[model samples]
Structure formats: structure tokens, C-alpha cells
Target: MAAERPVPTHEVTNQVPPVVGRDISTSPALLEGLRREGGGWAEDEVRALALLGNSETWQQAGRLANDHPPVLHTHDRYGNRVDEVEYLPQYHDLMRKAVAHGLHGAPWVDPRPGAHVARAAKVVAWGVADAGHLCPISMTYAVVPALRATPELALQYEPLLTNGVYEPALRAPQDKGGLIAGMSMTEKQGGSDVRANTTVAVPAGDGSHRLTGHKWFTSAPMSDLFLTLAQTDAGLSCFLVPRVLPDGTRNAFFLQRLKDKLGNKSNASGEVEYDGATGWLVGEQGRGVATIIEMVNMTRLDCSLMAAGGMRLNVAHALHHATHRSAFGRRLVDQPAMTNVLADLAVDSEAASAVVMRLAGAVDRAMRGDEAERAFRRVALSVTKYQLCKRLAPHTVEALECLGGNGYVEDSGMPRLYREAPLISIWEGSGNVAALDTLRALGREPAAVEAFLAELELAGGADGRYDDALAVLHKELVDLGDPEDLQFRARRVVERMALLLQGSLLIRHGDHAVADAFVASRLAGDRGRDYGTLPSGIDTRAVLARAAVPE
Candidate 1:
């Protein structure tokens, strides 16, 4: 008998190629943003990181890191109070790369212009490798600014925080080669209302404080230090609590439990019990919010960038999927409906990049003492953070659906993307918190409003729709019937602000096709809430060319 022919049923056919070997740094929008936003000097390194980010090894590393969530070990073999959290090797690899690239606190130390911009671009490009690991990185990046409020603290620790080395072990801050920081602000009584924290801090007489309280959520438990909030005799205050005391003895930072989160599995968030934890004050007593607010703003910028980067990841995956898979006798990308979907996703992704990069530029300038840029950043960062973060969920959903059944599977990585999308919105602050914060800036901060309007006016006459939207936004800003009503309408107003901001940047500096489509679809209100609802006569081909990988 002739040998049986191999079965064709098991053969894979018409499947999309692996999303590897393609450099995400080659994105037209990102490249343009880098050059336009003063990050051109870092282009070569960005490209190199893109190669590593897209490589098969790092992709698998991301998967493995997520698959094996961190475990909390409250004790050692002899039941000693080690208070350690163990992570997979893959998690450490990602952290190592992130710290080595200066994504944590290097910009604060680097006097070069556009350091923040370059850092933002890196967050956008390499962050696709694994977002969960970057949470600690963001907190570390953020803590630097808050530390500046205390000159001695900033002077002593700034060098260690900005060191481009990653040491995962728990050691004395001085003994460690480098350091990672965390935030222990919230408590069980109050989530975002950090002032309600019950943590108590008393003077230790050696200039440090002894802190004792139950912190509801403390991420990166193994971090060398935490910018925690507690109540002193004065009032609410910020404290730097260390895991290991300088004398080689452990601090009383106990990990009660590791939170089983919805996403960001690679990282650990814990319920911490600080039983007389050693601490040092950051900024003045009774000025905790005033001090930490600076750090929150910086972290919010990263949250915005993370949302933008996540959207780009979604589009890249969706485009790659559609480019290769075929149904109905033609490639999915060739079908009018799917073409509209991919192009629409691309347009939004490009807009996200442009706005985020511009915000980074504002931050870099603001750091250099540009008062106008600082004011613009106040309102712009708040609104951009709100919109981009909340927008990522729907964008991820639409992009995932483009893959049919395959997308729902964990192996495809789309499910992880879907899970990660909602995190940034909920983080920093939830939707209401973010929206109300923007309203607060608009209502309470006159300089912020004036600067934001001035920034909008920069794109005047560039697009009729943008001009019209700006006019409407101006009316809405002033026509508040009541405080409660404004709070109720905050989300609506913030969404418009986000759209106009994106439109303004795209029109001024984005690709012509990308800019035109964004203005007509977003500002003109011809588009539906969902992707793929662009109005007729828009150049889908041209819009997609900027987003799609070259054949």
C-alpha cells in the first residue's frame, strides 16, 4: 500500500504572520513626533529599542512574565519576617531593560534638553514589550519630582534614583547599586482620597519618622523606598519609607497580601502593614498633597503615554492580522469595511501619538522654567490623560475583534491587550476623578485656561472644524450654569477638549492624510462612537499607508 498522504486538515493556512521583525519605531507619526518634539537626538537609540521590542525573544518574555504572576512570601523557611515578593526571571529582564534605558528617573538627572521627550518616545516604543513591568518604572520616574520638594532628600537620593542600574534584591539604599521606588499613598478607608489615610508618623528623633498604618495598596513591594502618605501631628504629610533600614536590619514593612489584579499580572501590588516603619519626610508637614501633586502630574503624563503606546500596539497587531489573513476571496485589509476599520484605528493611533509627544514637549519645556508651557501642561495633561486612557479600551476591543476567534485566545496576546487597556484609566485616578480634576484646573486656575486656549489658537485657521470646535469649547468653558452641573458635564467637556487638542497637533505637524482625516472625522462629528465610521471621500488608503507595515 502506498504511504498515506499527510493530512491537510492540521496544516495552518491563511494565518497572519507573527508580529515580529518589524520595527515599531518606524511609525511615521512617532518618528515625526520625535523630530518635532525635540527628541531627534535619541532617534538612533529608539530605533535600536524598536528592534528589541519587536523581537521574538522579548515578545515571548512579555508573555511568560504575564503568565506567571508574582507571589508574595511573607516569611522564610524558618518563619522569619523576610517580607519579600518573588518575581519570575522574565519580569526582572524587562525591568532591567527599562532601568538601563533610563525610563525610570534618568531624565531628572540628565540636563540635556528633550530628555523627557526622548523618555516618552521610549515609553511609547518599548512599552509594547510589556506594560505591567513599567508601573514601578513610572512611579520611580514620578517620585523624583516630588523628592525635589525636600532639597536634602533630593540631593541624597536623586543620584541613586536616577542611576541606570537595576538591583532587584532588598538591601540598604546606600549599599544597593541602584534603587527602585514605590508609592504607598492609599488606605482601605479612602482610595483616591489620600487625606483620609490613617497611617501615623512620629518623629524618631534622628530626623526620621516612625510610621505605623495599614496601607491598602502598595505596588512593587520590593522597591527600596516608597513615597507614602501618613498623618503627623501637623496634618497629612508625605514620607519616604524604606524596606531595609540603613543598618542592614529590615523595616517593619509587612506585605499582608498581594492583590489579584484584573491585569498587569507581571507586577505586584500588595496590602502593606507598616508597624513602626522607618521614614523620612518629603516636603513640609501638613503639605502632603501639595508635595505629592507634583509627582502625580508626572505619572499622569506617563499614563497618557502608556495609553497612547497601547493604542499603537493594538493598531499594529490589527493591521498585521488583516494584512495577512484572507476571507471572502480577498485579503481582510482589502475589504471596504475592514479597510475602514484599520484606517480608522490608524488615524486614532496617530492622533494619540501626536498629542502625547506634544505634551511631552510641554513637560520638557515646563521643566526648563517656561511659565507658559507649565500652565498649558496643567490643563492639557489632565484632559489628555482622561481621554486617551478611557479611549484605549474601546480601541483595543475593536482591534481584537478584527482577528475573529483567534484574537480571543490568550496565545494571540490580544486578550492581554484588552485587559491592560482599562488599567491606566482607573489608575492615577478614575474617570470621574480625572474629569473633575480638569474642571478644577479650568475653573480654579486662570493661567492654565489661558495657556490652554493660547495653545489651541496656534492651530487657528488650519482647519475649519478645529476652529469651530475651539469656539464651542470656549463657550462651554464659560457657560457653567452651576457647579454641580459642570461636574456632571465634566466628562463631556473634557472629551471635546481632548479631541480639539489632538486635532490641533495633527493639523499643525502630522501627515496631511492623517491630519485631514482626524479633523473631519473627530472634530467635524461625522464619525460614530466606534471605529470605522469615517465619513465618505476620506482617503483611507493614504491614512492607512502611514500606519501599515510595508509589504
Candidate 2:
């Protein structure tokens, strides 16, 4: 009998190409989006973003996020309670770079015509590299407006907050050159319902209060300060709690345990216990929701921006893989099915970028006292926040599948992105919360709805599909029924409003091919429920070219 022939293993073919070492900021789609959005950042900001895209920076980001998750130090060697969170040096390095790039509070400090747009652009760039560090960056940015409720508090913290310095010490705010802030609003029981918080704040008679409660999720627990919600005699109120008291003593804040999260491992989020921690009231008692909401709105906008950035990165990775990997007889990118999916993903990324930047512009104009823009933002923020964040998870999963098994591995960075995607939806507010907020805004602020519709009308005749979608949305919005009925259909209504707004923005600012494809696939419902299902007639090549990553 002949010996059985043993076959050698075949070489791994059609494997995904390496996606790191590319300049993310200079990617065609991102730059085009930034240019179209009128991001008025100076040369320094542009250079900073480009630097973050370098190979070394990308390597550092990967290393920190994956191998160096934060560690919690609950007690000292001598049995004293230290409650310090220790981070790998890479995390601190990234934080410093982020602060130096003006990502934390640049818009507020600079206050230019398109200040928020500039800041949003930087954040988009940073998010592609690493997202965990942005937790503190975003919280600090959000805290500025809410702190203004108390002039004295704002005056005391503004310089520290605005300074482009990253001081991570758990010292008194007065002693630090800069400060990063965190938020502790959710309790184990309440979740998004801050009104259900069980924390109590007893007056200290000097405009300060002693807070006693626990936070289920306290992000960046080692930060110098936290903006938290607690119950007062009047009602639930916002308070500014520092890690250290004014007399150079440690506050009564205790770290119970760090949360083992799915992603965002580089940042520490923990369960905290406050044993009469000293806190100062930010605004009038009982106006906690209103005051903290100012911060919440800003954070919600960042959430959308981050999701958009993540989508762009996801598409870039997919495009990179397809461009280099060969399947059957041709490059995967050249295959018709792959091209359709890539183009569809590109359209989604570009539309998200356009809408987010437009929202940033609205925020800038509103800050400058543009009532029309402010009204538009009231409705647009919720709409975009709900839709874009919800799009991240499924979009990322589809993008990841483009690389098949390679993407599922930890080294490819795709899994990290997939883990990070759903967080934006859960962060500022979940989908239902955003949908309800949109409905609430429409009902309470008719002017907001009017301004939103007017903005959509700017591109009314550009695409037939868009026009049809807009007509349906308009009818749904205007021919309103009972509040309960509106609430029941809120998600549908918000989704339509988001699609119309995105379509309008793309028509006005995005490439013609990209805009057309978006209208056809998204607004017209000509495609299936997944990515890469674009129709054949659309300019898929143009969309792919625009989305290609810069080497």
C-alpha cells in the first residue's frame, strides 16, 4: 500500500494588510469633511492632529489601551486607605498630548467664530487614536458652562480648566496648574434617571455642602474634581466636589472598586462612596437637572462626534483591508460586492461627519447669540445624537467583518473599536432618552422644530429620495397627535428627522457622488439592512477613493 500523501499547509493568502502608521487626520474623507465644515483651526492645530497620526503615536495608543488598563490602589502598604488609581505612563502621555492640543477646553478658551467646530475636529482626530483618555477631556470641557452658574466658582476654576496643561495629581485645585474633571451622576438604582439618586447634600452654611452617597459610575475617579448630583432640602441639585479640601486635606471620597468594562480600559471608572465629601453648590437648589443638563448637552454632542470619528476609522480599516487583500482572482476592493459595501460605509461616515460638524457650528453660533441657530441646535443635537450613536455598533461590526477572522483578533484594533462603539449610545444618553428629548424639544420649543425644518429645506430639491423622506418627516412632525402617541413613535420620527438632516447636510457640503449614494441607500430605502448593499448605478469608486486612508 502506498503511504498516505501528506499535504503541507498553504500560505495565508488574502489576509488583511496592516492598517496602522497612516496619518488619520489627512485621510481624504476627514480632511474634506473638515474643509467643508469650515473648521477654522490654525496651523498649530492641524499639525497637532497630523502628529497624532504618526506611527509612534498609533503604537503608543495601541499599547496603552490594550496592555495597560488602569489599576486601582485602594490602600497603602501600611494599611492606610490611599484610594489612588494608577495608570500606565502611556495614559498620562496621551492625556498631556490631548490637553496640549487644546482638545479639553480649547473652544471655550479661544472663542472664535467656529471655535466649537475647531475643537470638534481635533476630538475627531484624537478619537481615532484613543478614546478612553477623552473621558476626562470631555468632562472638563462640559464642566466649564455648568460651572458658570456660580460666578465665584467659575472664576476660581476657569484658569485651571482653560490652561493647556494636564495635571493628574489628586491635590487641591488651587495648587494645580490645570485640572481634569469627572462626572458622577448615575447611581446603581437610578441610571439615567438622576432624579432617583439617593445621595444627600447637607448645607455647610458657607455656600458649601457635605455630600453623602455613592456613585455607580464615577469616570476618571482620580481627577481633581467631579461634577455630581445629590439630593438637597429643595430637591436634586448639582454640586462640585473636589478630591481635596481647601485646607490642604483629603476629602472624604472613597473608591469602592473599579468597574471591569468591555472597552475603554485606559481610563478608570469606579464605584465611589462619599462619606460627607465637601461640595459646593453650582446653581439654585432643585435646578440640578437644568444646570447639569448644560454639561449633558455638550457631552452628548461630543458623543456624536466621537461616534462619527469611530465610523470613519472603521471604514478606513475596512478600505485598507480590501485595498490590499486579494480574493479569488482580484483585489477585494475591486470586487463589486465589496465595493458596494465600502461605498455604503463611506457614505455613512461622511454624512455623520458633516452632520456633527454642522451641529458644532450651530453650537458656536448659538454661543454667539444666534437665536435661530440655537433653536436649530436644540432639535438637531438630539436627532443626530440618537441616530449617529445608534449607527456605530452595527456599522463597526460590518466593517470588522470585512477583515474576517483577522479583525476579530485583539491585535487588529477592530475588536477595540467594536467594543467602543456601543458606549457612545450608552454614554450621554441611550437611544430612547435621545428620542424622548427630541420629542420634548419639538413640543416645548416649536421654534426649534421650525429652524430644523428650515435647515433641511436648504437642500430640498437636490435629491428626489431626500425630498420624499423630508416630506414624510415633515408630515409626521407637523400632523402631531396626542403626547402618548408621539412618544410611542418617537424613535421612528427621530430617525426620519436624522436621515433628512444628514441628507441635507451631505447635499449641501459632501461630494455629489457621496450625497447621491446616501440619498439612494439611506433615505430612499433602496438597500438592505446591512452595509455594502448600495445600488449598482451609484459612483462607488468615487466614494471609496474619498474614504481611502492616507499612507
In lDDT terms, which candidate is top? Answer: 1
Every model's TM-score: 0.98, 0.95
lDDT of each: 0.90, 0.86
Pairs of residues at least 3 apart in sequence or in different chains that clash in candidate 1: none
For candidate 2, write residues 322-419 as lDDT tens digits: 89988889998999989988888889999888888889888888888999999999999999999999999999999999988889998788888898
lDDT of model number 1: 0.90
Residue lDDT tens for model 1, 96-161: 999999999888888989999999999888987898999999999999989999999988888999
Error of 1 at 135 (Å): 0.5
lDDT of 2: 0.86
Clashing pairs in 2: 341-532
